[model samples]
Structures are given as C-alpha cells and as structure tokens.
Target: MTGAPITADRLASLTTYREVVQQPAVWREAAETLAARSDEVAAFLEPLFALPDLRIVLTGAGTSAFAGEVLAPALARTLRRRVDAVATTDIVSNPREMFAEDVPTLLVSFARSGDSPESVAATQLAASCLTSVHQLVITCNPEGQLAREHSGSNSSLVLLMPSATNDRGFAMTSSFTSMLLSAWLALAPDQDPRLAERLAAAAEQVLGRPDELARLTGRPYDRIVYLGSGSLGGLARESALKLLELTAGKVISYYDTPLGFRHGPKAVLKDGTLAVVYLSNDAYTRRYDHDIVEELRAAIGSENVLAVSAQSDDAESWQIDGVSDVDDAVLTLPFVVIAQLLALRFSIALGRTPDNPFPDGEVNRVVQGVTIHPLQP
Candidate 1:
C-alpha cells in the first residue's frame, strides 16, 4: 500500500481525508460557538484589552506557531497595540529574551492537544517572568495540561476548539483553521462580519472539486515554493509545511514572501521546481505578488507556476470563490484548503498514507522528546 496509487476506497478510509473535507462545516460550527459566547469572551478580555500599554504575544508550536504568525498582523492593526507571533519553542529556549519586559502581556497560546511540553512551559515562563501577565489558551483538547491548569485562573482564559478538531490524523488540518477562526473572533470580533460564511463558501468550492485539484497535484514537479505577503506570508509557510509533512519529506518545499524571494531565494528556482504565489487582495501587495508570479512563470514556464488568487485574472491560477475583496486573514481559510488538498493528493501520489506519513514514529502527532529545562530568572 505504501507508494502505490491510492484507490477511492483507501482514500475514504483515511482520517486525513475526512478531516480535510470536514473543515468547512467545522469552521461554521466554530464561528457560531464563538458568536454565542462573544459576550463572555469579551467580558473576560475587555479589562485586559483596556490596559493602555498592553502587549499581546501569540505563541504555539509547529502549525500552531504559524497560526499566531498569520493572526498577529491583522490583530495588531485592529487593536492598535503591539502584537507578536512568537513560537513556544522560542519562548522555552530563550525565556529572558521573550519575556524581558515586565509589561502587562497577554499570551495567546494556540495548541491542538494543549499538551506540548513547550506549550505548557511557555505559559509557565510568562507567569514567572511577567509582573502582569494574562493567558488566553485556544486549544482543541480541553483535558490537556494547558486547559486543566489554566481552567479557573482569573488571569487565564481557555477557549476549547470544537471537539472534532482534536484531529485523529498525524497532521493538523481542521485544528489549525478552527483555532485560527476562534482566535480571530475572540481578538478582533468587529472585523470580517461575514467571515464564516465567506470562508465556508470558498472552502466548499475547493472541496467539491477534488478531481480538478488532483490534476494540479499530478504535475511532475518535485520541489514547491509557496509565496505570499504580510498575513498571507504566514499562510504560505503553513502551506509549504503541509506539503512537506504530508509527503514525508519526499518533496522539498520552501516558503517566502513574494518580495523576499527576489533577494537570494530565487536561486532555488530551476527545472522540476514549481512556485505557488498567493496573490493578495490588497492592491498594493498584490502588485509585488503579481511580479513574482510573472517572474516565476518566465523562469520556470507558466506550466510550472500556480497563482492562488481571489481575482484570478491570469490563466494559471486557483481563484478562491465568493470571498473576494476580503482581508488576507479571511482569505487564508480558503487558501489553506487548497494547500491541504494539494498535500493530500501529493501524499497519495507518492504512495504515502496521508493519515500517518511517519509510521515509524519518527515524527509523532503531538511532537515528543523535548526536555523542558527550568528557566532560571
């Protein structure tokens, strides 16, 4: 079964496939839950947000870290405060650097199991180092260490994702989007009023057309580069990771901002490599993205480059439908679906099981083998 064509029956049996397909519905449910609990969430956050010099840090590991990166820019703009997306791995490795300032800080942790050693240690380090620190844990597992420890703390708030999002599969699909949507709703409730509907519509369109998407994945390219700008740059990073993980490193994948690629990264482009540029809705940023799309097309041939856009003005592009003119953060929802499907298809193409690409336990689902050394003051 390994490295063979994945038949329909086999595909149906894979948890990754079901998780990927269930995302749109999961997003809608998550949005509705967040909306219903808006007042309570607001009540808990209002005072903390009211602090004039509040500092917000979004922390998580792996895919969870990318969520913070994707949400930070837009949240900072909306809240008019300093917002940072730092990985828990970084926080544990260098607590003094991460928590040097004793300012009032809000550590928003995005976790799937809420049990990653770094996840727990980062929160602990924040409380230890900061004089006035609050925690907002957006996690899938309610029983995990993070949720259990922070459950009743006046300074901590735990928002559990939809139960199904805990993700039985090794790779995180629904959990990432679920936590991202939930965090956006909690942090910036006023923006993107129709985010859930628009995201669900666009994602449904992508999910309904697997055959067409499979065609794109069927290409012989062995290397992939995903490019974006601003919030979409974080999206691009996650997209590249999905491909690399789902293929179990069989494919070499890279990610960079549309403009950043020009500096030295462009040297990586050559035969057997494909570039997927995520075109931004912001006209200003889109220009740079468009420039790269054109450059990659000229360099690698149009057949080897793909433009993921909402406008879809070009020939070789995947247009996310019904979510046009939205913020790049909202667009990431549908954009990620395209990447998830691509990764799944690529996994099948290489005869790797999408559910468990690392059957030998080389890379566990929740991540393992990290010793959390006590951070000395």
Candidate 2:
C-alpha cells in the first residue's frame, strides 16, 4: 500500500485515477471539440458575451462548484469578462440575489449527474426570472435530466464530458477533475498546445513515482492544510475534500490561499499535521507564494510541508517540469495531478478503498438521498 500497488484490482481502480491523471489530454480533447464548435459557441455566445449588460455566472454544488472556482479567476484575467462561480444551492434559495433582469446573463452549469435537485432548479429559476439568459450545461451523465431538458433553445448548449469521468463510486474522483478541465478548455482556447502534453506527462510521472506521494501520506497527520493561490486554490480545496471524504473525517482537512492562511488558519498546523503548498508559476505570484512557504518552514516546525510548483523554489520543491511555456492557469494540471496522487496514497495509508474511500456512506459518488426540488414560486 505504500507504493503504487500493481495488483489487478488496485490497478483497475488506478485505471480511472490514471486516466484522470491524464487531465491535460482530457482538457485537450475538450478544447479540440470546443474549437470544432467554435463557430457554434461563438455564433451562439458572441452576442451574449458581448452584451453591454452581461454577467457570466458559473454554478454547481460540491466539487462541481470547485470547477467554477478554478475557472472564474483565470477567465476574468484572460477574457477580461465579469465571471463568477456560485453554488446552485445559493441560487436556488435566493434567485433575486444572484440574478438581475437589468443585465443579459449566461449561467454556465456544471453537474456530474445533471439530476441534482439544485442543478435543475437553478437552471429553471434563471430562465423563468431573467429577461435575457443563456445556459451552458456541462455534465457527465448525458442521459440525465439536465441534458434531456434542453429544448433546442438558442441560448442553451449542453456539452458531455468523457465517459471515464462518469464515476460510479461514492466519491467523484475522476469525474470532478474531468468536468473542471472541460470548462477550462471551453473558456480558454488560446493557452498553449504543449499544455495538454505536459499534463499527460505529469500524470505518467506521478503514477510512476507513486511511492513518493504514498510515503508522504503514510505519515501520522491529524490535521492537513492545502495552501494555494489563483486558480490553483480551487484544486487545493478539492484536494482537501478528497482527503477528508476518503478518510471519513478521521483526518481533518482545510484549504486556504497561501497569504490568507497566515492570517488565522495557520493555527491548524499543529504536530502530526501536513501542509501542501501549491506555488504559482507566475514570476511574481510564485515569489510571494514561496515566501509564504518559507515562512511556514520556519514557524511550523512540527508539520510536514510539501510544495508543488511548475518551477523550482528551492531544492525542496517538487518540480513539475515540461510546463515551462504553458500558462500557469493551464499548468495547474501538474499540481492537481500530484494532489490527486497524494489523496489516493492517503486513502491507502488510512487502509481505505481509493475507489470508495467513504465506507459509512456519508459522502457519495453521485450524491444521494436529496430530492430534486422544483423552483419555489
């Protein structure tokens, strides 16, 4: 369990995770498809994106919400457009607060199953209340209600992600990352051609060196902190969730930005703790990020610190090479690839199934026992 176990069953489980590790390829496929549909998305989205009074809203729940978290900041920076990632849970309860009739709005919804109550409800409510609104639906379950409900509305676009991303276990391991990558491809087409290749290589690199991450996870850590900045923050949050969910609350996990963590959250770095820092590739950002990490190294004596970055901060840095020219936004894959591997190794350390890390059913693959409610009048 300390290394990449190559048993048939474990290897099978690793298959989905390995495929997910190839997220750069997945992103490439999504980008290529989106490119092919550029005319369609453009002809359809140009005016909507160009609206003088337009707001682009990204909505989802759980890890799906994290997808938007990763894309929103990067999109705003690159596209220079007003974009936001809001949870469907928030939108369903407070439509007026999230929507406005004064502006043309486009709601980009990410759903793993597309059947989540809030997913459909939020979509319906937005259409019902907003004067000019469009829907961009991304989901794994093409047969789910969200995909089926699209009525050829000129404003609606439903894109299906890869099949391996449609996870069947109680946790969204691959599916979550896949959907998130899909959005990145859809939103940023001009990044770099080598981005996907670098990510694919990173996947193989991490999987090949699984023992390294597995050994780190095998440590006795009661508290874990994931520190990141920019789009990588979303990946940090997801990584923290994976450890928490897979371990069934045995290991407490929290996610925060590098600078933000020093404020008060850093108090969690007690003995038997793990700190995972995701440093940015942007020259200035990484400098600040590494500075914060250096601070942690000096003060957090008892906690084990693991730093992942596209460039080397010091000898301790886990260099995610081959992503030199790739935008840090797209280069996020290497850090995420490493984080996912860490989570899996941690699951093994805790003697749990990486496939279904949650044994008591507190967390689930598609989520469960929730009624998909209708929009309240």
Candidate 3:
C-alpha cells in the first residue's frame, strides 16, 4: 500500500507539518513587513548607533531565546558593536548582573505570541535597570503583551511579524525564522534588498525535496546531535530543541559548536547515535566545521553522519541550492527549514502527533507557569 502525498494541504491534518511547509511563503511576507517599516526602524536606530559605546542585547525565552543566540554574533559583526544574546529567563532571575554595566543598551526582544511572562518582565527590567535602554520588539502577535504594551512608547519600536507567523501549532515553525529574518533586515547595515527573496527561493527548494531528510527517519538511531560554528552554533542549539519538542523528549538531542563538542560533549555519541553537522559558509569557520564532520563520521560510521550545507564540498551532504555565497547568518534562514522538516518526519515516524506532541499539556505553545517576581529599581 502507498501513502497520501505529503504537502502543506495534505498535511493540514497536522498543523505542525502545514506550518513547516508554509514558512517559505511566510518569509516572503516577512520581508515585505520589514520593507514597509524600514524607515521607522532606521529613524529609531540611527541615534543608538551613533552612541559609540552602545550595547545591543537580544533576549527571549526558550526557542524564542535561541533566535537571539543565532542573531547576536552576526549582528555584532555587521554593526561592529557589543551584541549579546541574553535570555529573558536569565534577565528576570538576575536582572542586576545582566544589566550590570549600565551602558547605553538596545534590547531586541523576539517572541512568537509575545505573551510569555518573561517577555514583558524582561522589558520592564531593562527599562528600570539601565539608565539608557531602548527596545525593539519583534513579535508575531499584534495583540501580545510585548506588542500591545510597547506599541506607543518612545523608547521602543514594535515590529509586528506577518500575522500568519503567529503559529497555531504547539511548536514554533514559521514564527522562529520570520522573527529572525525580520530582525536581521531591520537592524543589519547595508542588507541586500534581495536577500529575503533569495532565502525564500532556497527554502522553497528545500520544501520541494523533503525525501532526503525524510529518508533519515527510517534509520534505527535514537539520539541526534547537531553542531555548527559561530552563528550556525546558535542554529545547532535550535535544531536540537526542535527535535526535542516535536518528539516530546522521547528522542534525545544534543547541540554544540564544532570545537566545543570535542571538549567532552562528544561522549553523547554511542551505538544508537546519529550526528548532523551544519556546515559553515566562512572559509575559516568551514575548516573547523569540516573537522567535526570527519570526527563524527569516524566515531559513528560515515553512514550515520549527515552534513548539511549550501556548498557541495562534502559528497555526503544534503545540498541546498538557489542561494549563492550567502553568509552563515543568511544561510541559517533556509538551512533551518531542513531541521524543521526532519523534526516533523521524525515525529510521525515515532507515532507522535506532529500537531500537539504533548496533548496532555506537558508543555505549551506559549509557556505557562512562570511567575514574574517583582523587582524594585
């Protein structure tokens, strides 16, 4: 017997699958939102850029927090400033240390629903802790606490993601990349206006050929490790989390930078382990990334390792074309689509519901049960 064809429409039975496939189209919409708000974003940021000592901090919680991790290094390089990816979870619990320096700071918050407890608390914490702090709220929900509360404030700018990105599924699929892309275009200097189009084109190509990633699901491996370097390091962290979330933690996933994995974390490899390397686009960084791929292959057999890359340097890679010579940061936009597809296929393979892996509410679409302890400035 054969199976029903897999498509955004055919997969409508599972919102997660639908959203995963819909991301490329949604990203094109995200590009338009940033283009429409480009002037306002610049008017709000130019003065902050002039302050030579400005510190840009990106913050969020859980998967949302990972968005900051991916963007921080790339943005720091582009803007040439002290950019840090600090989680809102870290800020609420230890606002003082997180805001210790009291330098002029720009806090960019990324959220899907924007209603998470830490999302609002961290913004308030930044406003009170630092003498000079500005905020850029990049979120999917227009009515979320972050968007609603910060909409009119002179000290901040609110950039609403394409509303379709307010993902309805239990996990964040469209929201993650859209918010990441929106922030990059709005804040990065001299961004190619065509980058988003390129990203969409690449992602569409990935969405077109899901069979390679789907084939990995047939393997007997139960543990997966994702590794990359620099900005791709953050993408590694996110890819790990996506698998964990979609699998309801039934499958173990680990993440680290290629260099850091050698420091002891490589022990996660075993008989049932599979390693996925997210290759870097930088010639220098690519060397370290390639080293780890070879090491992982040696430890877990060549067939158990998969190299994901935009370049075809590796004969064993899952190649993504349509994007040419993009930076690792930009490469992340489409590469992540590969991760999202794998998680979806793996979830179904494990007899899990891709729509709501935790039907019992073990976890939620928007986090629950985080109490915001009031802090006095």
Candidate 4:
C-alpha cells in the first residue's frame, strides 16, 4: 500500500503520524511566538550574555537532549561563545561533575513536557550547585512543573510554545520541532525575517513526498542507519531514536557521522540495512557525505541507500527543495520531517499504533518510576 493521506480516520488511527505531519505549521507558529516575545527573551538573556567568563549549557533528556545537541554547535559558532550540550539525565545523576560553584552559568533547558522528573531535578540541581545560575526554560507544556516553578523568578525565564505544539501523541513530533525552532530564533544574533517562511515551505515540500518515502520504508529492512556531520550528526541520532521509539525497538537502528561510521561502526551493515545519509551543504563536509553514499551504494547496491540533500544529482535522491539558501543547521527542521514520516509509516506497516506503540507500559509518554534522591551535604 502507498502512503495514506492524513484524513480524519488516519488521525484517529495514528495520532503520532498527524503530529509528525503538522510539525511545519507548528514551527511557523513557534517562530511567530518567539518573534512576538523577542524583546522579553532578549531582556532575560542580554545581561547574561554580557557577563564575563559565562558558561552556557543546553540541556534536556531523551529527544529533548538531542535538541541541545542539534543547536549547540551552531549557536556556539554564531555567538562566539563556549556552549555545551548536556543531558538532564547527566545532571540528575552527577550534578557535581557537570556544574561548578564559581562559574556563572546559563542552563537552557528544552522539555516537551516540563513534568519529567529529570527536567525539574536538573533545574533545581543547577540552581543549588552553581553560585550564580540563570535558566531559560523552553517547553511545550505551559502548566508543566518546569514552567510553573520557574516563571516570575528573577533568575529564570520560561518561554511557552504554541498550544498546538504540546503534542498529545506518544512520541514528541510537533513539540520537538517547535522547541528546536524557538531555540534557533532565540540564539541567532541577526535573525532572518524570512526563515520561518522558508522552513514552512521546505517542510511542506517534504510532507508532500510521503508516497516516495512510504515505498522506501515498505522494503523488508530490519536495520536503519542515519549519518550526518556537525549539527546534522545530532539530528541523525534523533532520527534513529524516532524509528526505535515508534517501532517499540522492533527495528534495530544506528547513527553516526559519515566519516565516523567507517571506524568499526560499519560492521553493522548487512543485506537488510538501509542507510539514510543527510548530505551537508558545505562543500567540504558534503564530500565526506558523498563518499559514504557512493561507498555504501557500491557495497550494498544503490537501492538500499538513500541520500537526503538540498542539492542532488540523482533523481532517486530525497531532495529538500526550496531550502538551498538556508543554513545547514536551519535545514535540519525539514530534514527531520523525512525521518518522522518514515518512522510513522514503518510503525503502521508493522501493525502497531503510532500514537502509543508500547501497549504493555514498558515505555511511557512521560517516563515514570524514578525516585529522586537528595544530594548529601
């Protein structure tokens, strides 16, 4: 069967698919929200940015953590400041190692649902461990603990995303992309006025090509590999997780940089593996990406390897049209749509509901069963 349009029945049957398809619209709303509240966001951040020897930490758990991974490299370059992407899981587990008492720090926390135990714990732990600490909470849930506890505080600012971005599905789709776009807008020094429009256009183009992607996923592949570089490497990781999460771990997945994959990780490749390479726009990085695609195609046949790029020579390549001028980091917003759609399609193909794949409760929308321990004085 070809890819199905997201009709009312599809929405009822696969809510996760709907969330995935609606991300481009959510991204536009998020951009508008950030643009409207730009002054407020700036007021909270400008003073912190001026501080001498300040440290910036981008943090969250799971997919939220990947958000930081995707943005940290580009933000550091754009701001000419030191920025680190750390998971809230690391903070909650080892706060002492992750934070210092003397350094002034800005913890940019990304959370789809602010209620995650690690999310709250990480914020509180940062506040207690650092002598001077400020927080920027970017979350989809306005009523979530992360938003409610930190709002109105002199040291912290909470930016709630668009209402539709607070996704109801099992996996985070709109919430993830929306929060990602918000961070891009917040940190970019010279904002591009047309970026949001370009992102929406690019995503709509990808969304319209679901039949091609559906046919690709229709193959009986048991393993999926995603490869990229720099910020795209982080996106590759997130893309791997999307398939794993939606499939309830039925399909094995791996992610790495195009160059790094040859270092022992290439052993995972076999007859049933599908390699999805996100080609870089930079001439230098694109060479490595292209080399890998050529090597993989030669070794495992061209049909098993897929290349996603803003520029492509092959007719089979999944080209993200209308975004050639956008920065590669910004292009990740549309690149992710391909991954989301593939995961949703694979989930349906496997006879699982994309909304909530794990019926046995081994995994959950909001993680549970963790006991928060107090730090010893």
- On TM-score, the leading prediction is 1
Model 1 weakest 10-residue run by lDDT = 1-10
lDDT of candidates 1 onward, in order: 0.89, 0.74, 0.87, 0.87
Worst 10 residues of 3 by lDDT: 1-10
lDDT of 2 by residue, 238-328 (tens): 8898777766666788999988887888788777777888888778778778887888788765237888766654778777676655655
> Residue by residue across 226-256, what tens digits does model 3's lDDT show?
9989999889999999999998887899999
- TM-score to native of every candidate shown: 0.97, 0.90, 0.96, 0.96
Task: Judging by lDDT, tell me the better candidate of 1 and 4.
Answer: 1
lDDT of 2: 0.74
Tens-digit lDDT string for candidate 1 (229-317): 99999999999999989999998999999889999999989888978888998898888888988889899998888798888676668
Instruction: Tell me the spans in candidate 1 whose CA falls farther than 4 Å from its real position.
Output: 1-7
Backbone clashes in model 2, listed as residue pairs: 117-372, 170-364, 170-365
Instruction: Report lDDT (Cα) of residue 318, candidate 1.
Output: 78
| Winner by TM-score between candidate 2 and candidate 1 | 1
Clashes of 1: 1
